[model samples]
Target: MFNDEPGDNETFLYKLERESEVQKLIAHLKRSKKTYVRRRAATMLGNIAEISDPNERRQAVKALVSAIKTDEDDSVRAAAIDALYQRGEDAFDYLVAEIAEMGGSEATERTATTLLTEWLSADHLEFRMVAATALGERGATAAVPDLVRALTDPAPRVRTRAAQACGRLSDPRVVPPLSERLSDGRQQVREAAANALGAIGTDRALAELVPVTQADEEGLRLIAVDELGQFGSVKPVVVLVDALDDDSTTVQRAAMLSLLELLTTASTEELELICGTVVDELARADIQATVPALLDIAADGTRRRYRQTAIWLLSRITGDRYRSEVIDCLLPAIDKPDEETAQLAEAVLPELRSPELEKRLRVYLSRERGSEEARSRAQAVLDEICDGSSGELVTTGVDYTYVDSPADYTNQHSSRD
Candidate 1:
């Protein structure tokens, strides 16, 4: 009984029938010398303290409350606090009531407040981290203000958890304080802030995220790119498209991914304009995620540039579904009797599954008769459309078309629509 046999007490707790073993585990916890044994016993006691039946659980919770406040060891105390949550709202409500009652009784009453204070202020990082995490999980919105202040805590980890806790509250008011942390000196803290803002995900949050795209550091920029993608608005499309040219692959890829997300709703014209920036990369076929997105924009040809962009976008698509479109665009361009589009089409045709290039060389003799510059470009595009594949491919850097990058690859750009 003293040993608590790893699962014995827990087994009883799971069944909600450990009145005897619960007492034994509690006593052993008070006497155990090894920290691990005491901690384990404390956890079991906490678990046992929970009864599925409300009336019974009230009594069980009282004993656990006593354990949390009076445990000789810090670990035991922390474990008790954790287990308290499992007892459902009864345990916590009881705990809060106890704290209020203690305030009225003895001024020296070491209540739940006392325990909470100690855990948050303790020198041990894990204790504070766990306490913050548990509070966040509980999602006590009442604690949002306190969590906000903790954002400035000297320990980055604590502050990180605080941001996380605020995020869990999912309250808009937390946006300001949380946004402040985006420029946090610690990368870890910045990442935490990014996650929080992304999770909260309000327009206010997205607006705050916009400037971070140009943050001096690439890591922060990537974080901004990643977080922005969460909202999938074209508002950041220009921001992300600009990033496509970033010197760092990490930043570029992040931007690409963001754009891909935005493309789900972005207009074809918006996508067309975006083509030039992304098509070349698509053609490289290296970043498989951005391939479909480039193709989607390419297919929307309000402007020849978009088609041009599509042609370039086509070079990147190599999937089995992509074979036909790539072949059709290049095939017509080959003999469109125009050199440039013909050359461009030929460059990407191997991307298709037609007879060898030699076999299809003369296939487009009709369309190639005129408009060398025009026909060549048109035929090249036709080839891509003919060989287009269909699949939902992964992409990045998605933003709204009308809001950002209003350069208008087509004759006119529409910001309102």
Candidate 2:
């Protein structure tokens, strides 16, 4: 029934001084019959909160809180809530108090849960998002149905918050819907849904997540593979192993990491089973793509066992196929402060003995730029390879025979060597 030009209020509000403007916007926010006018006034009040005047800021905040309590239109109320949020942490307390007051002993006497549930159906997107988040935080089981419906909200953030809230609730009923969101167009939304499914952690939730690793979208497959690790069950090991061959390098890396996570908690039988599957998969995988990921895991200082596994995988996968690349990857590990890691790198170097590897090692030793300890390690490796003691290589659980001429070794020593 009310009509006004959109720019009319904005122009008039801009002409007023700061103090008068705050008061004028408050009047428009409280009395404007036009929905857009009230919405704009509420938005302007929030903007005014940034001013240096504490009294003016207080008045603007009070007006916004009043508008939220009395506004008939959901859009107006949503604008007020968003504006309060923009005012920063201090204004946020008022917003919380307003929500809490809804259930206070007044004529309406609406319970806080009932009001939040009702707001989930509000016309504005912010209202639905805040309502969904609050319901989940409160553990309002009765609001689960509404929160589930919110998972399909038109706004991606609303859907994301709803998904997160559903996760906090950890209700099995929300699992199917959360699973559906794993295919949501937005990456954040898809990730939220995957997280929610993981939080539920039911057998059914696990079942839903396992198949998503094979989803056509690499993003979905990545999320599923990552989430599968949190289950701490060996059931996803084979799927994760198979994922090592995924066409996407990122997904393949995620699969490898998930396998490592599973290894941390697997029983002896499970550990052997997983290790065997991984070894078999590595044999079939295009492991060249995984070199970077393996190098990172090996370099990580947090987990010794995983680091050992990474080094072993590198040896088995690269073999002699990627001589130069393997040398580059392992060289830095040679002087690592960790004795076991340094030893592991030194041990694997001989297994990779080839004319090309020896040449690269000699070049590394010749460089004046490398660390002294690393240079020393390289010198020893060069010595072992040239000494022909590398003839019976055994560290990597793999064997190779190298019969390079003594002449090849004689002049290969660098100035430092």
Candidate 3:
């Protein structure tokens, strides 16, 4: 009783089915040989799969699976497969088994590869899209080669989905093909390829990602910067640091996050190598803008080692600028609970040659509320800078016993003037 138009009469058919026309519709679905009629009928069965009645839904699922397995019309089989996919995982096993059975036939040679390849190339866009997703959800390593081949499909959606599937598979062998898509004309495809390379996370994939960071697109650059952090290598460090100057704030933030991760994760030796390069970057006026971020790491670093490294790096990079520009930022770390942070700050103090160092030290020594250890640490720094004056000040605080306590001399300079 339905018209020739596909899916246009579904609402009408639903009304009729509620009026006891369900059997007639099923008979029409089973007898129809015309591809469009069968396609619409199979689509209608999917509508039934959504029914709240469990028994009715099972019957619809049974019909949809039977249509996929036995239907001779290509469009009809595709429509039935799409219907099952729309039902989500409830019908996932049937789809996988059908594709696998088709893939394995020797004489027919309609193996899963052959079947998925054909579905991905199907004339209808929906078939190609669903087939790509199915391949990904199947999550088989064997699907890698076929998904790689789909990377160049004529439709951008197919290519995009294929790239996404390759990511889910995370196969290193797919890296080259996925890498080529990083420059795909479609932005979605480019993103999918970059993400796939990230998921694979192989040396080859990392190599592929380096070039992606150089891509003219900001989104791609941001993705590459983020992914490169996982490498924990010299190259990613260099690229991420350069990205700190990127015009896009998003890219800059991503670069900062990645650089921080590298800083926190890299071994002392790795930090040494990375720090040398970072210091060189800091020397250039163009790269000086990144100093605030370095200061943040130093002042509030999450790890003791990273905090020490950050302070050390800041010291070297800002040594020339300290008294004039960076000293205000460096001065506070001397009081941190982390002794290394305090010590690193102390080490950089002499280099600054600021008169303020001696003034702050005297204030710290005179304070009755300070840590003896902190005061001791402060006194040692004072001794290194003030030389002979340190012994005269020794009697002012309990932290200094290394030099003779000049009681009369201490009384003269002990209080803050």
CA lDDT of every candidate: 0.59, 0.76, 0.69
Q: What ranking emerges by lDDT with the best candidate at the front?
A: 2, 3, 1
In angstroms, how far off is 85's CA in candidate 3? Answer: 10
Runs of candidate 2 with Cα error greater than 4 angstroms are 1-10, 14-37, 44-73, 82-110, 123-125, 152-157, 183-191, 201-203, 214-218, 237-249, 265-269, 299-308, 327-334, 343-417
Supply the global lDDT for candidate 1: 0.59
TM-score of 1: 0.47
Tens-digit lDDT string for candidate 3 (1-417)? 324455455566566445534455555567865556667767666555346666766666677777767887767777776677676666745666555444434545435555666677678765676678767766657667778888998889789888988988887789889989988999999998999898887767977898777789998998899888777667776677778888887887677667666666777778778666656755663435566666665556665665676566666656454444455555566677777677777787666554555655666577533566656767777787777475343444555321124784566566635
Model 1: CA > 4 A from native: 1-30, 33-70, 75-125, 265-417
RMSD of each: 16.6, 7.3, 8.7
Q: Model 3: clashing residue pairs?
A: 102-110, 103-111, 103-112
TM-score of each: 0.47, 0.66, 0.62
lDDT value, residue 50 of candidate 2: 50
How displaced is residue 222 in candidate 2, in Å? 3.4
Consecutive 10-residue window with the lowest summed lDDT within model 1: 391-400
